[model samples]
Target: MIQRIQTIYLLIASIVSGGLIFVFNLWKTLKEQIFVLDLFEEGLFTLNVVPFMFITSSILSLVTIFLYKNRKLQFVIGRIIILMNLFLLGLLIYLSLTLSGETIVSEKGIGMFLPILVVLLIVLANKAIKKDEDLVKSVDRLR
Candidate 1:
């Protein structure tokens, strides 16, 4: 179970959502002075939700990894995590686009893309889980 490729994928997804988010800034603002905004720092009210979403996604990934025996459930949870990441990605895009007035967002940070990475990892994990399920079903048919 723990040795499965899906487990590894889920673990990496958790790490990306939980650990890497703090290491990178989300965006830079050029309002007389240039400064970076990490997930915790408040920019837009909606942007504040990003950190919470990341934490939730990380927890969900960890939970899904442990549900390896139930491949169908694991796959379902992975889909939920993917949707969560998609929501976060949309919010990030909204924040970047709506930045107004003196504070023009000069650049988007690598952290802004973390959700996309998480989504990709979750998708891979789900694919692996599906493969495992199919294998189990085929083995049952042989018996």
Candidate 2:
């Protein structure tokens, strides 16, 4: 079913994103004591944000899948969750920008791109869920 497909896509995205975060965190901790990449020196504290976002995203994605599976009809709860996620993301970005200061630096860098990618992935997942609901509604109307 369309719902199942959407759920699967969400699951994969969550797992991949979460795995990346876990790995990044692990690496940070492991190399914290060692003088490694100079890249780590700049804004290393910001790296802490990555794991939290990914883990939260993963948990939300899993919860959404389970909720969809059990609900026979479209539920507003999923949309609420998605909205809350967007709010949380916005807060994180605001915090980052405030802390990073007013620099006209390039916004196309990986640090900027990562958060944008995560937001895009979640938005797409939400769209897929909406599509599934629309399909169910169409089928219900025929029956």
By lDDT, who's the top model here? 1
Question: What's the lDDT for candidate 2?
Answer: 0.51
lDDT of every model, 2 decimals: 0.83, 0.51
lDDT of 2 by residue, 11-63 (tens): 66566545543333221122142111223445655444444555666676666
| Residue-by-residue lDDT tens digits, candidate 1, 1-143 | 88999989999999999988767777766643222234457566676687789899999999988887788888888999999999999998887777666244477778889999999999899888989899999999999
TM-score of each model, in listed order: 0.88, 0.54
TM-score of 2: 0.54
